[model samples]
Target: MQQDTVLVVGGGPAGLAAAANVNSAGYKAVVVEKEDVLGGAPILSGYAKLVPSGEWAKDAIGRMVKRVEDDANSTVHKGAKVEKLEGEAGNFTATLTNGESVQAGAVVLATGFTHFDSINKPEWGFGTYEDVLTTTQMEQMVASGKIACPSDGRVPERVCILLCVGSRDRQIGREWCSKICCTVSANLAMEIKEISPETDVFIYYMDIRTFGLYEDKFYWKSQEEFKTKFVKARIAEVTASGDGRLLVKGEDTLVKRPIVIPFDIVVHAIGMDPNADNPEISQVFGVGLEKHGFLERAEQYTNTCGTTRKGIYSCGAAYGPETIDDSIAQGAAAGGRAVADLHALVQKAG
Candidate 1:
């Protein structure tokens, strides 16, 4: 017999939104999360204030987790993953790693993207120097209410944020932009200034893509109000200075000259990469992956969230680098689509 349930993989913002929507539609939602907690990168990485909304990741994503957990129709499996999927649309059985089997009419893959590892680009001084950190690491520092250097307890007088650490670089083979890195870096700059007013923040970038509403909100506001410096430059490498400070070597494209700047701290605005488990997810769910290793969408226009498999849908960063708000919206849409399909199947059976 077909079940009135939707199986949602991953427990990030997108997965929570999908489960909540499904439960609201009077259908059961089985959420399978590999981690013990419901929240994804934001909670796992300990993010501070999110972009656009400016809400704390815990509060924003916490509400989503609460919504899903409160519903009686929703069943969440923590520290478990869907090991195998059998059967077909409207009659699917998913075996979990935790020894649970869920029967569902549809599935929604909301597995999010992974943060680009800064270790791959060692010249940037991530693993080499404790003062050099990723955006996520900086966010953790901001959340902790401290902006001191990891190497030493001293507060940094100058911090340089290098944009597109693992993005738009043919050498790394990550040609796609990570979408939110620019705006996020701008927001981070403002936050750093707010915390430590005396510290000057410089952002080195190829292009400032604040894009649409974020231009005035994050990029322009950061420069005008917070005095965050925006430099059009290509960073070559980050090395140690004679005096123990970090030297950022790069070319100022605007002036057409190479320059080496010294900074107390260097921040790498890392990009988003395809989920590490995309291969396993593709194999278990019988779905296809696009060239970038993200879950392939069946059709962009007609089936916005549908995967290669008929009863399985996908949304959020699983498709590509997506914003949290967009991911939630896509998750809700995918949930609605799955519910509608299930309803149609029920009608046909009747």
Candidate 2:
């Protein structure tokens, strides 16, 4: 059994950051990542740019991955998933899909949130229409250096982004706002305008939620210099026109009138969904999950990284929608908590 080892699941920013801190504290940390590569969504999704900074997303996340990879006390298992978790607190055993079991003193569930599937909302015509894409797909398009209409392969003349596609909708049973979608959509709008200056980008949103102090700058610039249009409305449906252009139908809430606009492409600013593996991970680790399926924290006010179970902790999107910086902060906090818990466990055994 590996004493003083912390099992960090999900090799994303949070998991990597946690493992790095654990190593810093003179502990061995094993990171089990379900993907072949390290950086999670930001890498897997091929995000061209990161929010707030406009720096290359890959460059920023790559540095974190490099640190974890170089750490002597940290072992990263790529393309591995946690199949089972047994025991508790100080003496936990995690069985991996790759037919390996890791013994650890604590566990940190950083299994991040999955992006909401835009196809689930059929009215948006994500799958049916070639031009209708999710924000993630749009990110990919931007990364690929071409934001052309899929149907015609032409740079779009007009682009419409529909915010809050799968979030804050009572009809879908997901009534919580995905905290990052607004900022991400706004950033993408500016990115699109920067990529193709002639492209007129319109964002149809309920509200422009640039929640933090520094993030509001991007939103302001999008309206000012980028010439992005903001429409206070939710898109009802998207359909293809006779000429192969997409038509977006919605009610302009501000004017209280129904409007249909034709566009070259429509991007669905989708929300985050609970990780599909959350139920299994929660049950295996004996941790609780929130109503929205994010890993539940021990206490909202007092304890930040502690989970319902004593030796188990959670951070990053596993808890909820959080920025990359916040996820890393929680990762460090979780690392500190794991160190304290393990030290106490060792002392008791001694």
Please report the candidate that would top TM-score against the real structure: 1
TM-score of 2: 0.97
Q: Compared with the true structure, what per-residue lDDT tens digits does model 1 show for residues 1-350? A: 44599999999999999999999999999999999999999999999999989999999999999999999999999999999999999999999999999999999999999999999888999999989999999999999998888888789999999999999988988989999999999999999999999899999999988887999999999999999999999699999987889999999999999999999999999999999999999999999999988999999999998999999999999999988989999999999999999999999988
RMSD of each: 0.8, 1.3
Q: Runs in model 1 with CA error above 4 Å? A: none
Clashes of 1: 0
Question: What's the TM-score of every candidate structure?
Answer: 0.99, 0.97
Residue 337, model 1, lDDT? 92
The worst-scoring run of ten residues by lDDT in candidate 2 lies at 212-221
Residue 308 C-alpha lDDT in model 2: 93
Q: Model 1 scores what on Cα lDDT?
A: 0.94
